[model samples]
Target: MIDLQTKLVGLIGKPLEHSLSPWMHNETYTRLGLNMAYLPIEVLENDLETVINGIRKMNFIGFNVTIPHKISIIPYLDDIDPLAKQIGSVNTITCCNGFLKGYNTDGEGFVSYLETSQGINCSDKVFLIMGSGGASRAIAMTLAARKAKKIYLFNRTIEKAKQLASEIMSYYDCICQAKNLDDTTLKALIKKADVLINTTSVGLYPNIDQTPVKYDLLSSHLIVADIIYNPLHTRLLQEAKEKGCGIVTGEGMFVNQGAKAFAIWTKQPAPYSMMKRVLEEKLI
Candidate 1:
């Protein structure tokens, strides 16, 4: 059905061989009867500028940004949405008539996932985040804006966590603390945390056994959330479940963000259910 009129959209990132965005977006387009094609484009860091310039010249509707490009791509963009600007990261982009605008759906999308799946509010909640990357930054900023009581961050590099905590505290007026991840500190923090978020790729596919925290430390009162969708159920979630703790996978986060991007590109209500189902099937 593709003709001269068919539109093209894609995801751009290094190591995109594992991405499910193409399957999810293309299936959604098919079900909605939209003449748009979605695919994954692997672009190395050094080639980002050239690729971006090519995007400007092409007839592409838009493309999703990922990994190292999220933060680094900001300068090349013509404009950036407020949320993306504040987070200093962009995961979604809108390309229209040579004008490229960047936006970050990660914050709202993750919050939406939390609300939809757990019926939980970030207001006055205590969170333990296990990373200081772009994903962690967006999630932290959004949770802070939600007026979360406290966000305890732990990263392999303590300085990165401290920097994120300082930014979150200064920008959003929330209490954020940076701490080193160790058996002693993790156990203490878990006892007080209402939720634990894994923003890293520890339990991602091909390394399914790696977990950020030991399941033995988990409690029934804690809610474990991970941002890896390939496996649907990460080792962290499995361990959380073993302790009768509430758990959420990254599937909802991934789908919710895609829904936001879909709306941005098409100016139509995304087929949310179909997109999620497509992703689920692909993950399985």
Candidate 2:
């Protein structure tokens, strides 16, 4: 009883079996009575070009990129959204008029979710971001653009952190600094931070016990946010919560970013309630 005329949309990445995009998008399609099917395409690093070309040739309307492919797929794209280009990564892509255009909804989604869900204003907050990967870049840049008082990035590797911080400072003309993730420095940063965000994949499903920062570094004054949703409540967030700090999970970011991407492709408002319900059902 399935429609033969359904359009195709999906996510492309290596090891995509763990993704929740298909469920999220399919639920929206079913609720809205749209003839669309979302899929997860497991693409290998060596076969990125071939997979992209294949998608272009097929009837797929769009696709989401994740992990190792986010930045690497940029050069293969025919066009890139300015914001995505500035962020140096793309998590969403749309096919229009036979051309693939890349976009980074992660930043917009993260900022919007923080404002609406937590009600934590970013105007003058000193934000401390852990990790210097794509998600960190997007979040840091968004905070800087919003005129955050100051932004600091901590990473195990000093050079990588410094590089990301320098880029943000240059791009946004804001006070951005990078530091090595040492006990003393982390303790100091945690004490002074109003909002602490983790953009690394440390506490994801398979590695649920690991947290980038120690529990001793956390304080009740800090607002901790983790971008890992699979296990939902990460150890870092749990510890922060135990310390009475406000916490936000990665689920908000996932839903918001997916909604934004859906809007970009369909040119309509996403059914947020339906999307969230579907995810909850699956999680249960």
Candidate 3:
């Protein structure tokens, strides 16, 4: 049990009913005997400013930003972390000296998980990213910073994908290109990709049938990753596994990112083992 006077923290996003952040953070806080509570604040687009301003006046210590608010919350922040600025998104926010500072723990979380769990150094790998949204930007920027040999982005909208590629190229020396996910182009790209990542909402809940790439295009040499953890193993990951490709689930990303946010909020090393145990228990 934690001290009753512990601080409050939480996640802010629309439709946060499915979030596991509260469970993970509160469990850690209890395990450490810290006085903190994590909650979920579901806010729509119009309520964004109101919610942020309210956080300032509340007893909240910090909050994790998610989904639609990741990029939209940037303008409301007092300051942004350089990495978050570069990635053009913020997933972690902390109150420091009466100011809210935004940070992008997603990139660091992805890189850390890759190194620690998969032993896969992204530096020399060719990355084919699917999506042009906030998650894709963070993942693409991290891959470029890690010295990925080449990074290709495929999105339904060619212009959006190109825009993301342009932004990433400004800071890192990498061959970044964008492609439209036509049947022909997608098949060709998947055949050549060493690491294929789905950063889009494809294969997520309510749209589990939709996958960014065709399964027939995948090969054993590919390392397939989908950032959809709700179903544990997305159809994309399951199909890739059937093809003998290495698979990485979104749970790894969720745990790592949450751990980073927990560390930032408490200024203490995250209780990763305890956190993971809590997550597993909730999942079961």
Candidate 1, residues 1-284: lDDT per residue as tens digits? 77779888999998887778888898888888889998788989999999999989887888899887898899899999987888889999999987899999998899889977998888868999999989999999989888998999999999999999998887887899999979899999999999999998798888999999987788999989999886888999999998999899898999999999999998989788989888878777
Local lDDT at 199 for model 2: 92
lDDT of 2: 0.87
Tens digits of lDDT, candidate 3, 53-83: 8889877778999988999999999999888
Computed on alpha carbons, the lDDT of every model, listed in order, comes to: 0.90, 0.87, 0.86
Q: Which stretches of candidate 2 lie over 4 Å from their true place?
A: 1-4
Worst 10 residues of 3 by lDDT: 1-10
Give the per-residue Cα lDDT of candidate 3 at 118.
70
Q: Which candidate is the best by lDDT?
A: 1
Candidate 1 Cα deviation (angstroms), residue 32: 1.6
Better of 2 and 3 by TM-score: 2
Leading candidate by TM-score: 1
Q: lDDT by residue for model 2 over 188-210, one digit each (tens)?
A: 87878899999988888888999
Worst 10 contiguous positions by lDDT, candidate 1:
115-124
Give RMSD (Å) of candidate 1 vs. truth: 1.1
| TM-score rank order | 1, 2, 3
Sort the predicted structures by lDDT, highest score first: 1, 2, 3
